[model samples]
Target: MYRYRITAEIRRDLERIELLRERFDNRGTLPRRWLGRLRRDLEAESVAASTMMEGVRVTVEEVRRLLAGDTPPTVDELSASLVLGYRDAMSYVLRRADEPSFAWHAELVKAIHDRVMGGAFGLDAGRFRTIPVFISDGSDGEPVYTPPAEDLVPDLVDGLAEYLESSKELPAPVVAAFAHVRLAGIHPFKDGNGRTARVVAALAMYRGGYRAPEFTSLEEWWGGHRGEYHTAFDCLGKRWKDSSDVTPFVAAHVAAQRIQADALSLRLATQREIWTAIEDRVE
Candidate 1:
């Protein structure tokens, strides 16, 4: 299992998340319809960013179009498939997040990958790799990290599921972070590992009661801060070793959540002002 401690800073960040979550839950005067629109926007942004991280060149606008069942002329077939596939996967995660019977298992993980990569290309959809896979350095295509052999993937994924099941005591953010890093490290599927890992992390947060709209937006942050996102995985080393402390990666995940919460706070304040002004005008 990945080792991490909830440091003082992380604890403080979690407090901030709690505060912001409270604000989201208690919307004061913001209308539910307005929140619905914001949620859709977040969904589009998330789909675009998560797919883009895997080198898909779809924009948020394109994603919105695809979600609306309209295809942009400029979006290639591959990009369209990638965007829509991810949108479906995120939708699946959102639906399952609140289910009381949800369990972390190899099938759930595979199902997420299936939704993400099912028809995007001819690539293997939900099955673990039958051969070796390597993470390449972006520019030169040189191998950077070697995932565990194909034989170990099924057991490793099962172990991950067990860990998630038993990690209920940990904070949601920590569990989310660990899931993200571990899945990425495991590279269980032949492709879509990063996307699957992110979706799994989002599921963790949602199940832990962080299902507010703003919580779904971290993939946008990760999309923009790709360098930091990849660097955070340094704790995993060049292989799937269990010895390294993943505190830094967990800290980074918490920080991302905090940042998103702060952004949402500002947006909420602005919206509240607008709402107040409209009320005064109507009065």
Candidate 2:
């Protein structure tokens, strides 16, 4: 099983995230229509961010247009396909998050991969890679990281499912962090491993009741800070190994939660002020 110690810093960060989440939840009540608009906007942002992390070149506005049943003339079919696929997978994450019977399983992971990669790149959708895979920098095409042998992919992914099921007692952010890195380390599919890993992390957070966009979506932070995001996995070394400590990745994930939550708080305050101004003008 994958292992990581949740240091004191992580705990404090998690506490801060919880406090911010509490405030957001307790901020009286916004009209359902307004909340719905926010949800749609965040969903578009998440889809764009997650797909863009995998090198898709679609903008958030393009994704929003696509999600709203309009095709942007600037978005090519390939980029549009990737964005719509990710949007479908994220929609699944939101639905499953609300379900009382949701559980971690291999099939569920594969299903998500299918949604993410099935449309854009039909390379082994819903299936683990039968061939070995390596991560390469686009410039040199040299392998930066080599995953486990193809033979081990099945067992490794199954082990991840088992670990997720067993770790239900841990805090949501911690579980989410681990889920992100573990699946990423396993590199289960031929492609879409990163996208699958991210969706899994979101599912973990959502299932743990981190339903707010600020609490659930890290793709925006990750999409913007791609370097820091990849560097967090340096602890895993050049290959997958059981002994690798994942503390750095977990800490980074927690810190991202805090940053995003803080940003959301500020954003909400601005929105509230704008709203008050509009009301005053009307009066």
Candidate 3:
């Protein structure tokens, strides 16, 4: 069997259902200003993330060109335009490819970090090490685990993959929650594990028929609640270290998803209102 780790397809499905519930609850009463502002914010975030990952070489006009169905530039061309090295640019393009699901394993996380940070951070892209890695603002710290020494990783990943494949029929929110917590507990990479886990969670949700996983910024949300996020992960990690039961992690995942859903609902309502106003002006 293909071993997998921390796949959360079911949890993401549930999130979509909940989104629908919120939309229905609001009925036709959403305001124009709110809807317009939310749409603009969402679009702005998308552009910012794309630029951050892709680099500064590609201008807004170039991005618009690509989005307008123009022939997409090659990785090398994009890199030259974005002022990034050839490999870094290629890696960014590959990660955002339509085939992102092709690399749904823990190893892929390291690969992505290395690709993104190789020249920028002078990191060795070939090997996984146990060095300490931290994010900006002194948050997101953890001792790294090299694969062979960290024997639990492979098994944990396999279990996660099995869970995902077996529970393919579950809701997206539940699946996303499952994938997020399991990956977070495993803490697979020396760096970028959280970001990678979030990406995987988003991918799981996307594959399960939800829109792109960029709706609510989990990173932005978790960054604001760093202490609580870490505490929840630590709680689950301790349980996994002792009993191997994932209930605690699952609970945390559900709670986080609900928070995200609530935020998304508010944004969606706001966007609906804004769009209505824009439409009225056009008329």
Candidate 4:
């Protein structure tokens, strides 16, 4: 029962992400050295930020050490699984960006969930939720929002996949945003729903060639604004199942895309200047 109401504001934000995406469409806009700088610690930072949004008490330092094969100080299994699993799954999304073999499907989303929470929570990963759950306001208070029933999750997820496939008329960013909200509203999985929703959004963009030459994580941006993020979710009302407009969530997400795109552009430009100066000194 959800449809993206693309306002003029959303249009502008999609345009913003598209411009940078066009710059990197060729995938060689940046020199190999610059690419190395961008890729150097991007994945770790992105994964760390994403896990943090999932309530993991982990930091980029801990993640970097863990990646370096060092034991993190006081890193528990939950934190470890979230950090590593999301990193692996994020790698898949970025890898599939270049590989044409990956296709949009419901099962593809499930596979990403598997990488996200499979081993972390036994039997709950990769499968749709069989039991009901509640979205919360970080309180033991009454449920904030309840998603569709388990029986409805499969159909709802499939509808989203079908939207991705059939909505060729829509801009990739817009479709990606819709995918993010739709699956999130469905709350398909028992756990990892939030992470999976964000990943699915990334998948839609990366697969659609929506990337800038520099590295940036939409998750990182969202993680930094958890209050605003939840506030947007709260707009769906106690009964998200009722037909309610999602303009607030869509508009805010698209606006954040512009903020991130601008940030990356500035970062890349500064890096370019530094790289040029280094080249001149080297010669």
**Top TM-score model:** 2
Candidate 2, run of 10 with poorest lDDT: 117-126
Off by over 4 Å in 3: 1-40, 43-121, 124-127, 130-148, 151-155, 212-217, 237-242
lDDT of 3 by residue, 177-278 (tens): 667766666655554455445555665665455553333335435544666666655444323352345545555555666666567667665766667787
Superposed by TM-score, candidate 4 places the C-alpha of residue 99 at a distance from the truth, in angstroms, of 5.0
Q: Candidate 3 — what's its lDDT?
A: 0.50
lDDT of each: 0.85, 0.85, 0.50, 0.75
The TM-scores of all predictions, comma-separated, are 0.94, 0.95, 0.56, 0.90
After superposition, the stretches of candidate 1 with alpha carbons farther than 4 Å from their true spots are 275-283
Model 1 whole-model lDDT (C-alpha atoms): 0.85
TM value for model 4: 0.90
Residue 187 in model 2: shift from native, Å?
A: 0.7
Model 1 over residues 68-111: C-alpha lDDT tens digits? Answer: 89999989887888788888888898898778798889999998
Local accuracy of candidate 4 as per-residue lDDT tens digits, 36-58: 75665666666777888878888
Q: Which candidate do you rate higher for lDDT, 1 or 4?
A: 1
Least lDDT summed over 10 consecutive residues: which range in candidate 1? 118-127
Which stretches in model 4 have alpha-carbon errors above 4 Å?
Answer: 26-29, 97-101, 121-123, 213-216
